[model samples]
Target: MKVTRTRLTEDEKKAWRQFCQASHASESEMLKMMIRKVSGSVSHTSARNAEPKSEKVTVRLAPGDFKKMDGRAQEEGYLSRTSWTTAVVLAALYREPVLTNEEVNALRQSCRELGAIGRNLNQVARALNIEFREGDRIKREAIEDLAERIEEHRALVFELLNKNMNRWRQ
Candidate 1:
């Protein structure tokens, strides 16, 4: 192993210690992640997918503890305890939420609705283009209504994102 050292001001050292504690990550792990990020060797998505699982870890919990964990997992919308544990671990490592199943479904539905609205807008634009070519008047109210619906959907998407992000906040 190669060793590298850097000096930090007292304030910087304090901040680093606090960050490591809050993230539930070892200093070595945090330093490795920072190095990868700074060197442009890893991106958020790539880092998450970089490792494939080929190992298993088994844990033995007391019956009461296991029941509590199972209940918490279900409450968080995880289909299984394993999935919930994975999400919690990844969230700590990456400092981001591993979205719940319900969150994923909600986002999927929103995207589908947005796609339909986009298709409708395209059809309206095509009709307007033809009208313009033939000197026919276009309906202003129809365009305005479509724009309003788009805005509403955009807001809903943002709201969902914010809610999901907050769900994992410590």
Candidate 2:
């Protein structure tokens, strides 16, 4: 069997030993289990009934630590610690931003508003087309008003996206 080595900080070493002792698993066994778990290859059932693509990892935390982590997660605008942890892990893995709950909601709302503005613009264009087809005079004021509204919404969305990007850059 091939052997692998890793350098761990003092605290991490202590934590690893404690974890192994508490779980009654040898250090090598624990390490292999962690590798399998992270790789999503751990199976608890027979091959016929096992789900090969998905696995669950049960993390045992002390009550105090759980409460603290939950509070910290909520303070960061996450509904739960699990979601916050998942976002953090994924962001780290992908080198992407971990958006807070508020940021996500704001983005969703902005997209919806943008869609509404687009629909309104399409309607106005259709109306203008029909008026032109009928040889009726088009209202300049209506076109100008729609133009201004679209510009305002476009600016707002750009501002929102820029703000989010800046936050991630920092």
Candidate 3:
């Protein structure tokens, strides 16, 4: 055996700690196994089953459905539909709540609406603060309308969060 030394950044140190806790192995043992795997010096298998993979599954879908699935996966920042589908299926199997496409769309729309309302609110505030006294009454009425819209958007955000929270508990 040979001694090796290296430096790790703060983030790497944090990840190392997490890996150690999850893998239930000491640093030296884990590093040795990793080196062996990287160097192609060892083959891994379940202690009960030394045989390698032998099974595979294929899924079929309509072209349109596949396109939609791919679009949704990308919208959710997943690399591929397969990974997204796997995560959804695993969550379902574990009795965990996963958002449907409709729910995700609704959340996205709510975020956009809230952002627009906030911008309108800021514009109204700026208009009201301006020194031009000629349109004070009109600006006040517009501010009132914007305030009402902001409240409505806030309510929509709260409702969406409440609905998702309720669903997550199931």
Instruction: Find the candidate with the highest lDDT and give its number.
Output: 1
Q: Which ten residues in a row have the lowest lDDT in candidate 3?
A: 45-54
Task: Write candidate 3's Cα lDDT for 106-130 as tens digits.
Answer: 7667778878877877777677677
After superposing candidate 2 on the true structure, give the runs of residues whose Cα lies further than 4 Å from its correct spot: 1-72, 132-144, 155-170
The superposed Cα distance between candidate 1 and the true structure at residue 158, in angstroms, equals 1.8
Instruction: Give stretches of model 1 more than 4 Å off.
Output: 1-69, 133-139
> Please, what are the lDDT tens digits per residue for candidate 1 over residues 50-168?
46945676889999989988998888776457767777777768876567646666767788888888888787778887787643444475677778888888898788777756655
Q: Which pairs clash in model 1?
A: none
Task: Pull out the clashing pairs in model 3.
Answer: none
Expressed as tens digits, the lDDT of each residue in 1-170 for candidate 2 is 56889999997887677555433345776677677778898554332233354555578999998997788677766644766666656665777555664665566677787788678767777888777764334446566776787787678767765664454333
Report the Cα lDDT for residue 115, model 1.
89
The best candidate by TM-score is 1
Q: What is residue 41's positional error in candidate 1, in angstroms?
A: 46
